[model samples]
Target chain A: MKKLLATILILSLVLTMAVGCTSDKVEETKSLKVTSGLWSRPEEQQFIREEILPGFEEEFNVKVELEVIDNIEKVMEAQKASDEWTTDVVMTHSGTMPLYIANEYVQPLDSVKDSLDITFMDAFESATTQDGKTYYLPISADVYLLIANQKALPYLPDGADVTKLTWEEYKDWAINIADAEGAKVSFPLMPIKASQYQVGGIGLSYGSEFPMINSPGMLSAWELLGEMVKNNAILETSFNYDNPVEQMKSEEAWLTFYHMVPVGDIYSSAPAKYVVAAAPAGPNGNGSIAGAWGVGITAGTNNKDVAEEFIKYLARPEVLYEVAAGTGGFIPPVNEVIAQLGEEPKDIIMKKGLDTLENGVVSGVPASEYTDWGAVKSVFDTVFQEMWDNDGELAKDFLDAQQKELEKLEK
Target chain B: MKNKYKKWFPYFLLTPALLYYVLFWIRPVLRAFFESMTDYDGSFSLMFFSKVINESMFTAALRNSLLFALISVMLQFTVAFMMALLLNKKFKGSNLLLFVALIPMAVPPAAVAILWKTGFSTFGWINNLLITLNLIKEPILWMTAKGYNALLFLILIDTWTVLPSVMIILLAGLQNLNKEYEEAGLIFGASRFQIIKDIIMPILKPTIITAVILRMIAAMQVWMISVMMFGYGRVPFLVERIAYYTDMVPMLKESYKMSLTYSVVVTTIVMISVMIYLRVNKKKEKEVRI
Candidate 1:
């Protein structure tokens, strides 16, 4: 009986192992093959079927399957692993474009640049290149601006300039408003680490010649933030990037520095309730970092010509306007598109967005500014959180250490 | 002739499994060890291992990973043991409770991550309830805080997800225990707790050790929960570092080396846990024989 039991166990184990291996192999074989990758917002999936895909199919005369991978690193890794190029086109942030370029996973667009009439080609070219090779084209731009709750308009000093406030002036205004209305006017303490390019805004406000964290401007910026914290102008808890508009609508904060997307949505919902204006100018100048997304063709694509055409179509002014307006909150990257917007319905928020992009210090940092900036941010965020929560005094020390660590990447 | 045929039949049945172990398991382990020693820049070199060891995140990650594994496993085992003991008793709706307890196991890790993230947010349900009860004036940023709080949250979430599986295993062991041995101790005037401590626990010791070791090994390799809770380098777990290096760095050789080092460390911990279990089990067996 014992022998029989042992034999049965051995047979079952063999059967299970064989079945598992075979099933994995089968699934691998059956996956849909694609030459180009596509990424879009979850809401745009249906729209892609109705609008984007039909045109691409008709233009290319080839049926292409879309591979939707969310994480940026995974998309890069997937391209590396697969022998035959799977993604022909990829949509990614401007920050990640350098890694793709350095690894030679993205091909230059010079070959097809002459064939297409791209309205924003010059503007897009300036921001998306490394060493004279254009690897990506801009799809949309997002600018940061100051949004105010109309209820707090009465508290503002009669002659105070909202557009150009020194650090001291902005802090004093925030404190006065906070004292009058509890928790009503606050800056979001939670920094968005994923958007590394936004760091340029902080550097810009600090009067730094370069976007260096160790500069005196950065120290001044930190001191300004510390003063704000002491005055209760910043929230104790970190606020979500998407929730500030809701907070504004509910009268939580009178004024905040926020992206154009959420603020524009709030204004459209209740036009009379909120006013959006240009981000307050710093000691050096009125400047904010310009964040953008771009589309690039994957290197070694079988359908490179068709993919290039799609990119060209995406860069046209009309297409840019359609995507910008249809998306409902995004700012158009093209200068001509912004000029044409003068004919549209006038609003404080739309005008602020146009002015912010036009006047702000556009981020020129190469995508490869730091190799492990994510790692550095993760560590810095921990220190920042501690300082905010416990009133710790390690911000300068932490910044110094981070600068040392970042210097290693230069080697 | 019939005897020879039967002997060969068993060998034929076992051949596939033996081959599989050699090809998939043993070969990869050997390759990983060699790769760990080399500066594997896409290919192979011996200097890569030195580079990984020299990096500061390596040591930090190792320490964090150990702490996470130890704390999570101990908590999981204790909770699972208590639940298993409670379930071993006969009661109405006991089976229903067991079914309900398994719900966490059925939920995907990604979905559970999202749930924890929402529940632990600043203005989440937990904070809202706390404020309503006058427990605190403001929302506590549970997941965003550094050091102990973030680590504690991760462990709690992990324990919640894994405890049910551990409980089920211990419950089966309890059911299979010899009731006569316990009854005899009771007849001898031993108290309930005494009988449990002296007879039941000694017998259940092997099963408990097995479950703890399995859970420890699993916890040591934690990546998804850490990444979902705190992005790369924020929590600084070893596997998170490995993944970040692999994903973000252009140097594939260094990434492979780091991965190999992580695999070695995790494997070593698991082996040590198994060794402890074997040593304890041997001593117990010897004592019983005496």
Candidate 2:
């Protein structure tokens, strides 16, 4: 009986120790909850795991529990419903920051602006609200560009100048190259349905000229896409970045308009297969829309100080360059970081595309103006798809109908 | 006192379930009804319902939802009945076939949507096969058309996913039926079709009605498939529109109004269906006595 009692006592002590050890470890980890859309990709995950997390741990002595949310709206809903704002940081599209600001879901970083040495003065000048408060750090600038298969270049008209070609010249060159190679050129037709990235690019291109679709420049943009569809020059496939990259590798497509960042990966993987070039100038000159993905601290986070420090760490020039260059396709949003990354072959190509964004226009429309752009995209997608079916005239009618419906919201 | 204690024991045992129903289901439904009358966005308000009712999109969504529910349920029931009949027979690999039929139900809706998307793409297997067989010289744009085409695709996918559940319910109903009646018909020189039409179907009426009611209730909230395939407010359905209004509109009153409208319509339809089933069963019982 005494022996059994001793065994029980020993077992209980051992169990207590194990539990205590685990609890101690959990406490030491200091799991800072970071909510972001950035860590979704495998490459981005690696960068976080290898570089960002280590640097952050060494500086702040806190372990971050990064929750990579797939949908930004869902994250915001969760944050709002919970009220406590459990997440410490959020990374999302710059287009979406204004809605968060309007809703009071996010706190302004005005308090920590100076200590962090963040160039908030300039960054705020560009991305701040009318009330003079900055909400997000502009991290990487995603610009859409025309990428070409090097094999098709030989078939282009002599002195064709693919980079600066007029819309007509570009079309002619694509048709000529496609005919000679017996392969089609592909452009994302109504890509908003598949990915917001493509839609942003197309919207930017259109918005640059018209700012709103009613203008003549917007009409010409539509006409160009319609003409491309009619000519069979552009393949009516979802212009997924990966799809075009694969097509270029297999030589199935001679050229395609795509985002510049993902093209770097394609270049690295198949160096001999493809080359990158700027999107041929639109009618309003070479206007490309710029998409910036950035990080922001949540409003009610307990670790606001650490979160702000992490943001600074992420925004550091070297870290930005490493993420942009090491990950292959991404162009650092910071001009100095992009310049510091230096002029390697891929860097030079990315720099040429980045240069366009420096002068390029972005949608200056605040997020509050469009709360349900996803729903709007759905409406536009149906219209665009229908237009593709009914010889493109239907698009204008659909757009007009959509504008009427959208105008109700503005009212 | 002892007798009273015994009587109160059952109520005590039932309290948890009754409380659960009140808290989780009944209260929300009542709140939804109240909000539906007012224009509550997602908060307290009274003017939103008027705006919702005034919107053309609401009417269009209601019409589309009714049509989708009616057409999808009828088609799904028919297909499920045929599948249940086939599975009822004792053939080799019959269980395997039933298992395979249930695969769509096992697959997540999001995954199924993506799979269907790939299959429906221009360079997808279906188009490739059609081209190989010279069925069409050009690839058919399956998802691009307005009206019936998009709705039809959604219906087809919904039916495919829900058919297994319907089949299982019907199959159980089929098993519960006495084979003696069908044998009596066969013995009396009734053909197989006559046995099914005259004997089996009438007896199976209550089960079939129950299945139809269940399917209709399920189909009325068919937002996921619609949103996944056609997107919100594009080929709008009642539930999808409610989701849109809730997510898109900042006004709490408007969102609540739309949601309330959806609940009322769905609940009314379900109650009516149950009432009709009860009425029909009563009539059948009266006829038997007569």
Docking class of 2: incorrect
Candidate 2 residue lDDT tens string, B74-136: 999899988888898879999899889888878877777767766776566788899999999
Error of 1 at A238 (Å): 2.9
User: What C-alpha RMSD separates each model from the true structure?
Assistant: 8.7, 5.4
Candidate 2 lDDT over A1-411, as tens digits, reads 999999999999999998888774453546577777664667767877787688778677888877776566566767778886778888776667776676666777665554554342243245534387767776666666677777777766767776665556666776676566543675544333333334334445544331244345555555665565566666544333224654555454668766675567666676666766776665445556555666777777888878888878887877877776766656676657764656575676568667666655444333345545544444445545655676645456666676565455441
**Residue B89 deviation, candidate 2, in Å?**
2.9
lDDT of 1 at A291: 61
In model 2 chain A, where is the ten-residue run with the lowest total lDDT? A190-199
TM-score computed on alpha carbons, candidate 1:
0.78
Interface RMSD of each: 5.4, 5.7
lDDT by residue (A211-310, candidate 1, tens digit) is 4556786666656656666667665433333236545665546777766666676666777777667766676665576667777877777667667767
Among the numbered candidates, top TM-score falls to 2
For candidate 2, the share of real interface contacts preserved is: 0.08
Q: Considering summed lDDT, which 10 consecutive residues are worst modelled in model 1 chain B?
A: B247-256
